[model samples]
Target: MDGLFLLSSYAVKDAILIRPFSLADIQSVMEIQSACYPANLLEEAEHLIAKHQQSPLSCWVATEHQKAIAYLLTHPWSGDTPPALNTPLPPKKPKSDIYFIHDLAVLPSARGLGLAKRLFDTAIDWAKQEKLQKIRLIAIAGAADFWIKQGLSPVNDKTLSHKLDDYGSDTHYLEAAI
Candidate 1:
């Protein structure tokens, strides 16, 4: 169950594929983000573009019929606190031991096709290959439960809990050991 998995029988034959993000995919990535998230939750196009530029290897995009339909943006990070959402990533690249998942999104029509899970699997594979210690993310949009089911747990550090509040009332910081 790795590398270009079949996304159920509902999709067009061989239409789905996942690959690392490229500078050329920025426009499609923005459209997908807008379609998948509310304005308050969405990152600015400039920030998203900067993230990809900063961590090209960590960001991934999913395509159907060679058209962008979904994406997952990740980066190297440390510490128990997740980065604040919708903000610019730091310019310096660290020798990372942790993989921080920034965003994962799929268009409405692509739901139920297991695209998210596929992207998750890809990230896990990348983390394992990179010898990262853990994967961390801020689970919003009621996605905490979904991450829990995938074996991630809500962080319990009292100090980090305060920082998670910036993401919104229901945001939860989650992590999975590698």
Candidate 2:
């Protein structure tokens, strides 16, 4: 974990190493995923790794005391639709205008540490640097309100809505300008 990026003043008023995710963080990421999501919603580690390999610049893990407590997985995407649950990102995808927030999770024990927002700020910073138009994500379960507080408005496209059937009964598509 040497050379990990440290974000000392993310306004959480505590030290947290928000570092680019290395392959070594996969197991920890999976553990956090399992703790945060239901079995049917958990993504395979391979799919998560492919995303990291594809966009290392935007993928990040947050550690406190050298233990990963949260992570943000993101990548460039067309923004036409959210990927289905457990699906691997397709190869040779077309050019992208949106930066997709594939996953953001913090362990229950780590909640209220402002870790999720710090991790999200990491992704937003990347999207701004890339000059992507907007940030997009499917807020599964009942997490839409948390995202709403982040300034992403709910998307209302019927075509896009139909495609998210596999995401779950409570999934919601949301987006925000960069």
Instruction: Using TM-score, give the best candidate's number.
Output: 2
- The TM-score of predicted model 1 comes to 0.88
Off by over 4 Å in 1: 1-12
Native-to-model Cα distance after best TM-score fit, residue 59 in candidate 2, in Å: 0.4
**True-structure RMSD, every candidate:** 4.7, 3.9
What is the TM-score of each predicted model, taking all chains together?
0.88, 0.89
Go through the candidates in order and give each one's C-alpha lDDT.
Answer: 0.83, 0.87
Q: lDDT for model 1, please.
A: 0.83
Determine the C-alpha RMSD for candidate 1 after optimal superposition of all C-alphas.
4.7
Q: What does candidate 2's lDDT look like per residue over 16-123, in tens digits?
A: 779899999999999999999988888899999999888889999999877899999999988476777687787736678889999999999999989989999888
The deviation in Å at residue 17 for candidate 2 is 1.6
The clash count of every prediction, one per candidate, is 0, 0
Worst 10 residues of 2 by lDDT: 2-11
